[model samples]
Target: MVFKCQEDSFLKQFKTTIVSCDFATLDWVADDDNRNNGETRQLRGFNVICEDTILFPEGGGQPCDYGTINGHQVRSVQRKGSTAVHFVESPGSFEEGSEVQQQLDWSRRLDHMQQHSGQHLITALFDREFKYDTTSWNLGQSVSHIQLSTPHLISRESLDLIERQANDLIREGREVSVVLVDPATALEFQDARAPRGLPKDHEGLARVVRIAGIESNMCCGTHVTNLSQLQCIKLLYAEKVKTNVHVHFVVGERALRKLGEVFQREQQLTAALKGGASQHLELVQKLQQNVKSTRKSFQLLLKDFATAEAERLEELPKAQRPKYFALHRRDGIEVDFINTLLRNAPEDILYFLTVSEGVAAGSSAKGHMVLRGDPAVVQEMGPKFLELLEGKGNGKENNFQGKINNLAKIEECTALLEAHYKPKKAATAVEPASAS
Candidate 1:
């Protein structure tokens, strides 16, 4: 590698430096995974070396450093030779010659630091207390998890003990130590666990993070120097995958906030039940049943509502043939609406009717709409039908839907269909929004 540490040093918080370097090169190629999508690749951004960066290159299954550099965000940081190559995510303004100020967003950096630190502590606790080796780890956007190489050996009781130990360590507030040891010196510490297929020892310098009395590992990522930096560590969930058990967790501010929000919502639910908190679960089940019943009732109500609507259409003069009907169920949909449409049309006449669940923007909605008429009726009316509702629909079949963007043309839809399809002076049947 180009830039190897010669001595042990820690980055002071929020450090900034300016570097003037000649642009190495730039190119656009298919992103490796897809090999079809073109993504810009600038492998030499590592040329601008800064003193302090919280962005860790991809290590420990966590993603690489991503934040603004000068103004261009460094998408991913990779090690090319001895230099850390920063993958520029967005092209803003940079050149090999143009001086750029490299910086990291400390808040974002610190959050990752806390989580990574928590992971170290938790992993250490699990290994020591339950003898489980962390085989894989992934720190993601909302949660971080690690899989134990031998999951079957870990019982629920064992997991509880690990959680107790990890959180207790967080509460105790230990000083996490990052140490540099020569590869030979690293061998002296027999208990230290390092990832497989990684260098256990280096010639001159190696990076190892020690949770004071808890855990120690060879690491290249940024982390909180003190265990106290992680305000809280929340055990979100755990599940077994293959031979390994994956433990999901959250840390720091988010951990405490999520805990409080979940607790408070459960409390509110229990209060609504008016019984003990134990009854809250049963009460939730009852509420779900009530919603189901209400849905069935709403469908029956829609039949009556549509019946009255079709009744009003019956009152219209015959020339105003109600050849088109676009009924929408804005709040509650009814199955009867679709069934009624299929049953009631005159054999010789053409009619288009639909019941959509929700409006598309302000116009059409999603669901079924069927139109059957002279092929000419649709040829003249389909475009206008979608236009009035401010929606989009196309079909040469008896129907097509993905309509209901707007409801403005419903009346005109009735007017045009009566004039063209029914071709009767008094067949006008204007529909109205269901009052039910």
Candidate 2:
């Protein structure tokens, strides 16, 4: 069925009757699913079918339109057969055959129109100039990309050419019109770039959207009436994914908004780097080089400190030396420091050493640890130490090492090690004292 949205894309308000309303439940997820932190809600609502609506159902790489029905919020609308099913978020039901007011979200509709029409223009230009067919396209939240059939990568020169031609056509202000023709005669007006056939559930005449002096394509999505409404077009870049190349671009208000955002970021970078935009790259490169040199010097200093610590332990007299030694650093992930210390130290005293990332250990702070000395003690303590740190590792003979995260419990682990190696005193007999 030809939807009202397809008939008149500019229509923002329409009066329609509710054909049916059924109990329904929707599992709604956050719009930014990646950063939602595993949050989801079950939306109890009604599946409302309206006789006619300005709300467009999702189709042709375009998302569904969001709006309201009789003052209740409708978040989703989908096509079921020839009808538009509106998912109204409400516990109350809409009476069947009752009159209702349908409202369209104008900003969303305008944005979709700009993007969809821009895709049509771009597709036509690529087919005309490069003989490359558009296999598919994606209307992204920020930018849109069209998958070109060619395997050869598009160069910067080609991107500039296409972008220039697209804006020129937009400047020309060409008229865009839609025509409904008989299914049998549809092929006569549409160009070779048109889709092969109509949708499976398509009824009545086929709709073909035509750009003046350009091309005609079989499309059901809404679009702008004139090319000038697009404002501008900017072809960003192209990327090759396996077999096809995706050419990314922005259209109309999106291009303007993107420009503003980029300029704002540039101002922030200038303040942080203490340089103008022209010198930002050079300053960043120099900063990176300096950091590299400093890191190398710091690593050498850590090794020297490790060697000195080991030498101090070795200088202790045999009788005066403790059975075990524990050292912890609250600065970094310094496994090399632990290895260097063990290399220069005596093998008799059990050693427990750790280096964590923060000054004060939090539950999430990460670190590395090593236990060395007696093979028997190493094997016994390896698994226990991992369990205490909420980590994992394995050991064979004289050393056990692993990565750990829960550093807040390090004191408890140290106490456990201390109690294990504490010296025992000799027992005394009292029989001679009793006789005296």
Candidate 3:
């Protein structure tokens, strides 16, 4: 199949006749188990084949072009053995041999071209300057990355050198050319970098992209005709990935976009933090330290309050004392509060205590409980208490503790515990059996 995009990268619109059209479905498994039975979803669409097309299918580390065909949205484009299949969303299929207008999303196409060409230039420079070869690349939506075949990480100095040289070439406005070279005559080009060699099934000639006085390589993806079209190249950062270093970069309009986004964030931080861009990080660190110190002080205060609350319960009049002493705190009370209370609690006092960590009523809660009066009562009530709060806990002897999901149910759970442990009414005194 002849690809119009390869011949003319700037072709935004073209007229083509539909070679074939059929209903098709794209299927893929979701990353998460969100579906019943974990089945892959099928997206219904139409697979269209055109006599001549400007849409570049996804290949050679570049994404497919997104556009419209006959006013229908083209979702994706894929190459299947020399055939460019255009996946389009349409209610009815286009009839075979029908003429249609194809339009390429120029902004997207230009972005891909800039990134792909920038990668080629960077790859060539790395090889020339450092003997590092590019093994793979990814043309991402927002940024692009090149994987260099090296065990050691790339140094910042080396990256800066390569980036400077690449932008210099862009400023020089060197012409980029694509040529079809016969395999037998490919040896004439000494600067061409073809590590994998030509495919066995590759027809008569291999398509080679050459940057003037720089490097030439076998590439099928689209590119800008001139280096200046790239505007500029910025190497963002590099990281070691297994045996290679993946270098991230942005080119042309994307570099401008990245800069705009960063400056906007800087403005926001300046306004909110009342600090200059250079002082933002230092101020944030200081604020974090202050928060830590304040949190420690608050925790100590809660502990002291918990100790006083336990003492008040102990001082209650004997007649006013309830069968079970229960305390429910809506504020973020820690488990240590319960432990402090238990440490000072009298042996006969059966205690039900809860601390809600969540601020909202329906959020999760955590607590600890101790039943010290009766061994049988502790054993029976421990599991029931956890069940009421929708929690799981473990215990040995008279203590149990766990986390619960329903914070709103804490009051109801405590009430149930009070009722369960309420002393049975004194049995009516039996009158002496004098009548007998």
Q: Considering every candidate listed, which one attains the maximal lDDT?
A: 2
Order by lDDT, highest first: 2, 3, 1
- Quality of model 2 by C-alpha lDDT: 0.84
- The whole-model lDDT of each prediction reads 0.61, 0.84, 0.80
What's the TM-score of each model vs. the native?
0.64, 0.89, 0.79
Q: List, in order, the clash count of every candidate structure.
A: 29, 0, 0
The ten-residue window of minimal lDDT in model 2 covers 426-435
Model 2, 336-393: lDDT tens digits are: 8888988998777888887887544435577888888789888988788888888777
> How many clashing residue pairs, candidate 3?
0
Candidate 3 lDDT, 164-259, residue by residue in tens = 999999999999999887767667444567776765545656778999999898888899999999999999999999999999999999999999
Q: What value of lDDT does candidate 1 attain over all alpha carbons?
A: 0.61
| RMSD after CA superposition, every candidate | 7.6, 7.7, 8.8
- Could you tell me how far off, in angstroms, the CA of residue 21 lies in candidate 3 after the best superposition? 0.7
Q: For residue 212, what is the lDDT in candidate 3? A: 96
